[model samples]
Target: MTITSVIDPAIIQAYRETHFCVEGDAPLTLRIGEKNETLSALHKASGATSSAFVTAWNPYSRRCDDETNADLQKKLIDELTTRSLCFVNGVGRHPASDWAEPSLLVLRISLEAAKELGNRYEQNAIVWCGADAVPELVLLR
Candidate 1:
């Protein structure tokens, strides 16, 4: 599916506002392929050092207090970490934000690894290739 079709416009807007011009002048290209094969190729191409920023939103929607929100965020982080796909970078929060339950979780990961992680949680997750001049929403099947 296209990024616009699957992602909430509010979330996209928040992202744009919070991360404006973050991608810099680095160029990026999206590639779709089997997960393992893609990872191997990426590793070979970048000497096992290529990595990108990735973000994932909370799967549930509930207006919780700050404590509850923190707990939920931790759970999401743990889930993602256990998969060895990425590590928590930080959270994206905005006043009256309507996307992601509380805030979106950020992590640094390789493009192929992000793709693999997105595939595992395709129903409620969107991953981005965030290391380029223009971050691309990765479509995982």
Candidate 2:
């Protein structure tokens, strides 16, 4: 399936307006793959210069318990950081009306790193490029 097919139109529009539309650059391509392989590929492709904004969805907010949710949230953040992704910012709940409970966690890393990370985690990897009119999703697996 194509990236357009899987992602919602509203999301594409929001991302375009907030990310791509404002930034004038090449449109990013989203690629999916297994964890280790994806990281390896990203490292090889980036050659040390390319960087991207990485975002992850934290669904624990929907759960009933605050403590458990907090723990999970910390775990997610720690894991991502451990992998070398730097924390960027967090979008408040419901940044996109169409999206559900999960709040978004944004991080910055190499564009190649984001592509590989997207493959490793579900609903967390997004590639934004300035060249495209909208965000495009590609699954490498």
Candidate 3:
């Protein structure tokens, strides 16, 4: 079944077009609804069945200054640390847009927990992937 949301089509399209890049030693890029062999290998290596690419910037899609966005992102990273979750720093970047939001590729997060985090961060949606490694757009609102 297709998950539906109240978010605008244009915004959803923008989300789909974004390159969710996971940084560090094994930096990789993910796109919504697409499968990536690199991510699949990472998941296998890490023994992670699922992951979520999330950002705390521009809550509910509203523009925020760099400092504010960074502050919010720090909080998000803190939360993950508190939960002892393994994650790699990342960003959601749209090629056509200069704006890039700080993000994370949280490994082994359950769908429920990912949804909760998305809502908690006031994000319109998040990119989540299961064992198949196909990233899906999970709308929070």
lDDT score, candidate 1: 0.42
TM-score between model 1 and native: 0.41
Q: How many residue pairs clash in each candidate?
A: 0, 5, 0
Model 1 agreement with the true structure over 1-141: per-residue lDDT tens digits: 335445566545554444311121232222322133333344345444444433333432224566755675566567766865433243333445543333332344556665665454332334353333234434332
Model 2 residue runs over 4 Å out of place are 1-4, 19-48, 58-73, 90-108, 124-141
The candidate maximizing TM-score is 3
State the weakest 10-residue window (summed lDDT) of model 2: 19-28
Measured by lDDT, the strongest candidate is 3
Instruction: State the lDDT of candidate 3 residue by residue for 46-121, as single tens digits.
Output: 9999999988999999999989989999999999999999999998899898968889999999999999999998
lDDT of 2 by residue, 73-104 (tens): 56656777687654433332233354423222
lDDT of each: 0.42, 0.39, 0.92
Worst 10 residues of 3 by lDDT: 1-10
| Candidate 1, residue 134: how far the Cα is off, in Å | 4.5
Model 1, which residues run further than 4 Å from truth?
A: 1-8, 20-62, 85-88, 93-127, 130-134, 137-141
